[model samples]
Target: MLASVAAGLASTALGGAASAEGGGVPALQLITLTGPGTSGGDTGPGELLARQDAVLAKVGNPTTTYRWTTALNGFAVELTPEQVAVVESDPEVASVEANSVRPMSARRTPVPSSAQVRQPRATGGAGVVIGLVDSGLAPESPLFAGVPGLGRGPKDFAGSCEVGEDWPATTCNRKVVASGWWVAGFGPERIRSSEHLSPRDAVGHGTQVASVAAGNAGVSVRMRGRTIGEFGGIAPQARIAPYKACWGAPDPRDDGCATADLVSAIDRATADGVDVLDLAVAGPPGTDTVERALLGAAEADIVVVAAAGNDGREEYAAHGSPWVTTVGASLGSVWQGRVSVVGGPTLTGASRSRRTSPPTRLVLGADAAAPGATRRHAAQCRPGSLDAAATAGRAVYCERGGIGRIDKSEAVALADGVAMVLGNVRPGPVVDDFHAVPTVQLSAPDAQRLTRWVRSHDRTSIRMSGVAPSPVAGRTAAWSPSGDPRSSVIKPDVVAVGDGVLGAVPDQRGWAMFGGTSAAAARVAGAAALLRSRHDWRAPVVRSVLATTAVPLGTESVLRQGGGRAGADVRGARLALVVRTPRYREVLESGSWGDLNQSSVLVRATGSVTRRVTNLGSRAEYFSAQAIGFTRHRVRVTPLAARLSPGETATFRITVTGPSTPGHVDDGWIRWRGARGSVTRVPVAITR
Candidate 1:
């Protein structure tokens, strides 16, 4: 519940709210420019973006107005509202949106930690380079400190730290091989005043995410100022090159990493010969600058993994393009303290607030707001609206869908409310969130009942205490799944454990708890790095192997779970099936009315597509393919089973005939299996 809420709040809180340009006066807002370069134009995503430096210089004071967005046509500059209008007048400008950043965390890493779980002594991902494109790195963290066999940078890597005034020139070390920052955001002087002068992570997010992907092994997890458990990254042996695309962390949470900065980092990482690029950032939809850059990275043989945005409500809100390997957030097993209503259900949430008084004197926020504000605003717990006279030292009832859960807690506490009960607007399940005051989120039905009770009953009370581990462990987080039905493209390509993962903070000895698809993408990136270390595979092969070998979650739909939970056991299988054919999402996009029906694809059409299956094991392997799930159309695979040598690939032709009927989605997978349960499932969704 909080993950989706936090996503919105994170955008608002991290990137300061954009002040409107009133009276046609000059104001600071991100402006995107597009068109053929009149003065000078560059072709292609890379060259076009390089031309942006010149375009930005022409529009505003270069030093103060930061240029965002990578490609030549798109940019975020502080232009006058009139100047923005001037840009809009250009026919070439594709689209423009206000710039913002998403809050994106650590744990054993069910990762690099999971790798150790299977082989306790092994630190996976030797000889691979992983580039972290987020906040800069804290090279001094124990996770990045030099050690014997560990901490060695990949010799082929060719990137260096962009030193800051505060960051010593020697900041780049063997473990943190490279570092750079793109702070060309809305505010520069203010950013410099509050931010460190170098690529160092004053904001802890980049460090935390990088460490989660390839941090050194055997770091300890601390809470309440004491060690609770040992922490590790997914691929402990991979080299880390920090690319600080976003900045302003550790305070005010300014993660407004513009597109220009991201483009530079990605281009640099690709040139530096990194094996994988890990990004925890997101941008507006459509094929924008960074989206194009990611596609370029994919074509260059680099594995690009990105987060499915935290927005659970909108469809295709995720920043992922077609080629990138998109990942979604799933729960990791966790136990947290509970806060339940007197007659309501137990809720799963986290808070640092300590409640000393007996649970009683329940007061709803709508009842506490100052006069004139609607009950809805009161339930939203808008700041300053709550009257201290009405709700002093009582647990305030707040709704989840309106504002960030933490923001709600702050508003209630500001009103002198002792605690907060966050009721979820969307029913079914809750994701835990860290809070400033005593806060617990209720599920939908429970929240609805709590609201009715608050309206009907003058007095309400609730019980609070520690609770058992959440019953739903490692389930697809509601916000993690892409719900946009308008776009037929299936997403997240796969799911990974992201909730409550632990990783390093910028503070020398500090650590943090984060929950989002950002962490999930990092784990998958690290897993890919681990695979890179063991096998010489193309980007598609790596993606296919991971998807095929993943532990399929049987409950969720193919769109929700994709290939299931990521579990790439490089050491486990002697033969793995890698799918190369119509992508699951592509088939979905091809359907009419979102299905292969007579009204949609009215003509019964026949199409033949070649599916390539590769055996990536150490020896020759035998395999067969079967179409399982709903049969909306007829599919025939010639030579269903085959024997192939190690590293050899076989091609199978699949003939499909469109059906006469229409349906939501005909879901199934082309399953390929080998000895020892080595299996690969290419999820298929077509309607007619």
Candidate 2:
């Protein structure tokens, strides 16, 4: 870990931490401050810095410190150990942390397209501004050029713009209305050849995210001079304001979405007066600076949407705050292409297909290996570890878990293997991803069966279903993280079209595919912009509509899929489930789970709560309410038959009858189902 230099403490004159590169002189260091909530009021960054400087002058160093107020009231200064000791002892200095380098939490969504919602009308996102705090935004793409009548921006917009070397100042048009970059003392070593002092995207992540949410329709996509197709974002008419908070790291290849940079970026975006802030980034589990910024954004009536991250853990499911609707990734059925083994156990998986690649004989890697390496190393399929002469011209059977699937494929390809059969080491769904070679991964059991056949000297021939079927792809992408049952908060408010989503990118005539929660968040953000353009509801109600009306892939965890996939226009929802008190949102004083404090309804001898259901459909609808999934204590719901006329509403009392079990808390949701195929849930909690 790179750390700040802390030196020169003997003397009173503040000789702050000196740099390893620069001679004896001290370098700038981040110093965070806070007031007693009362003094903080109306105490701007300048005043705070002035007060701190006064303290420093009296005690040690008299040099002024650069201050920041937008991302929180903070300052950067070079103070000697004596001065630092005096500042740390001050009553108003709540806490101070060194600004350490943080990695990017890299990670989809498609609710709007499935909802049968179409492109935006003139009023679509008319006055809405969607701000993106990311990297790599290409203004040259035709997506921002806009169509004749719809591209003109809102009349009341309050924002400005900036340009980079390759990016012309005139490129900041009505659609892409604003641009700004936050460069935190970045020296030339970290700068990309194409990047200037401007806010252009040297990295492709920000551009892809921005286009997914707000770029206009009918943007052309081409690869190798051939037009693959055309693509567009959810809200093509919404105005975009880009903030370059993240930059390519010191290597000029990897990038760091640093907290200090992001906080400063948020401060700027908030000041820019954006209606919706879309960021496809998150850090480790905690209530850090970003969460505070999100809360502040929410309080200002700005809807904040963020990614749940790609860690794929059941517990500590990322993005815990309710104020920001957290998004998770899922694959569209179109992402799957069938691959099988003839004269073998029936196998179902996805691949780019061997039909497109050079043909080779099929054999288990162990069967084809040369006499030297261990069975484990050969099976792991590590590059350079396998004997190329023996395995050449054969399809390698490599086990998963030890290495990246792509790395295994690359190894096999380098070893002269025609294709690769990568099998899971543990139980997991078939996760279909495009590999460098025509490769397919099998589930553990399936792989085991194939291994047995190979060792038995039985003939095995692999086949390909060159064409992808139109049916639902085999389950949600197996890697899509689902929520654990321990926490009461309903995570991933929704999933979206994340698998292999094609969108326009930079580098003229370029197009690329994206997956993970970042893609999902962008899709939902665009839909939110569209909804905001036409509705009069506030942020909470908007979030509620997005959460409840979402469609789902049956059998996937409700916690992972939330309300399922999001739809474009929320008004199209036929039936509405309304709960006056949802346990997840209620604030509490003591008991907590992760970052969420539980304030659930107390379960009496017979636990019961009243829930109101309304028929939002044009005609009458049949509905039923029941508790779904497992619970430590059995959760029961009454009124299996709930019939309602249009505009009519009824209340259902749900009860938790069983005795408290071993777990300290009992959590469940009231799942309402309508004959019209409508499904929604409201979480409930009961504590002993």
Candidate 3:
């Protein structure tokens, strides 16, 4: 009788507002509830739905599409503006945000090494679970097959597989412990026929990421019926749990992930007990609803790694929250194609093509223009711009830009061209994409020189061969964006080898080279899983350990390389964390980037900060501190030397006093050496 009376009161209160906005479609909003009745222990799903239904009765109670309770206490619902106002007025609501749809922002080795760099022993990440929150997976690929010695699945993991078309419950094996997909917020009408309805990856992004993070070891990557090399994941023994939140579209660039779906995936992964979360997708900065869920994930002891956007140095890195480790792309072991000018010096450039071509006549793209085609179009090798007669049996030079790199090769193939020489116009990183025909890619200066040589002589012939490994170690890729000056926390906390990383594709037995920070994040995520498997540490400690021990990659500023390349040299390395007192924590409690207890330091203004380090070694030792690489600023460290016993903790202070010049930045490292051979380094960035 009491329940009937409450329902009657709700109807009376909401009946008039049912059609308050009149006739337009309702907008979806994500509402995060707090206080009581948020967690599963506090409120049952049925009871919560009844409460929500009564509250939303004023606006014609729509079905709640998503209910996130683990990592985030939120629900997604379609409501009119008037209805949103009603929800906002409720005392349980913490935040109400419009469901925002964002575009999908789309690592070669098991350990961090190439032909030129020193190799570290691979740490098989046994008993670790890496949760990938991105596109679906290719369950049939051999990369996700069970290992030889692997026994039972992880005891702590409670994730399950969602059976769908081409995806059976049996697909989730010991290697892939969990598989699921959420596309409710992405809308069913937007899903294309080419995409899968299950966790099976129609788009290859998720598979590539999973392969780089935790695929089976010693898998042969055979392309075009030839074995390229034996490849494996950095943490080959770790288990994978993939949650597909992003969906494919007809236009590849139109591929996007709904924010509502992202939050739900994060929530589920947290509940599933994943040790590491690899997020390759990009989203807006600051404390939005999604970032809030990331904080919840961190609080749940999950180490989150995200991709620094591929927008290049002009834009700031995305997902710059201090809680998540943002990773940038860097070129490692490179495969170059050699183009020998019949009588001129041979030019070596980036290449992903496996085929080699003998000497053939080379023609400028503009010189082979079809009738009625614009010179610009012909130069860019746009489809239908090349004349078949002029381009037949010749190596066409197509300038980068205007169209897809593969599209240029397609146009060349359509013109009966035997080969292509693709070149960039401006200074930037050259991606080695697998093309339709044999091709060579050159930088701006080299391309300009080649163009001049081609036009100067009437008959220019060139021979293209070799796609062998030529290591370009350490330098950060130009396409990976720099850190934001506005944020207090330095972004791109580490760099990883992202260029020309070979990984699994959607097709069975297919492998391809991938680039961008997506690959870099996977590498770091794998490394984080390795750390978790080796030691019992908190998420923040794991992040600090990686950042502090990173080796410098090139001469770029900390804004570009942060703590240099992502490395795990924790052997005899001291753990340093920024000291944050209770007062400071309360003052900056909104997941403050500046207040994070990270080892790396980023001083936007002249200020003094304190750090604490604990000796995790077995014996007592004395340590000395020294500053390296600092210029244009006064960096002083107090207590330059300290003596501590095993398991002892010590505190130190670092003061930065410098000119308040705008846009001026300085970088260096705080190195500490212990008498017992212990060494630790912390990256520092100061900006004015």
Which of the two candidates, 1 or 2, achieves a greater TM-score against the reference?
2
Residue by residue across 1-688, what tens digits does model 1's lDDT show? 1222233223333223222322344433444445422111235556655655555444443222333232223544444565556556655454544444544422222221111111122388888888888877777787887665663346567777677656765776667677765544423443544566457777677887888898877776554344445666888888888877676743554445655457657766765668898888765665565665565566556778887766665655465354567788776654445666576555545433334346667788877887777888997898777888888878887877677566787888778887788777885545444454566667787677767776787677876665544435446877675533345445677788777666788774577666678888888999999888877786667766666666666656666766778855745544433422223224323433222110011112346555566666778878887877655677666888999897787777656666645435555667777765676776655543
| Candidate with better lDDT, 1 vs 2 | 1
Each model's C-alpha lDDT?
0.62, 0.61, 0.76
Which has the better TM-score: candidate 2, or candidate 3? 3
lDDT of 2 by residue, 273-316 (tens): 78888877766555555665565566555678887776675434
Task: Give the distance in Å from residue 581's predicted Cα in candidate 1 to where it truly belongs.
Answer: 15
Candidate 2 lDDT score at position 186 = 34
Off by over 4 Å in 2: 1-95, 107-126, 185-189, 192-194, 250-254, 313-315, 335-488, 567-569, 574-626, 630-632, 636-668, 672-679, 683-688
Ranking of predictions according to TM-score: 3, 2, 1
Mind giving the per-residue lDDT tens digits that candidate 3 earns over 211-307? 8888777676665455545677888889999898888877766677888788888888888889999988766666677876776677667888989
What's model 1's TM-score? 0.65
Error of 3 at 360 (Å): 16
TM per prediction? 0.65, 0.66, 0.77
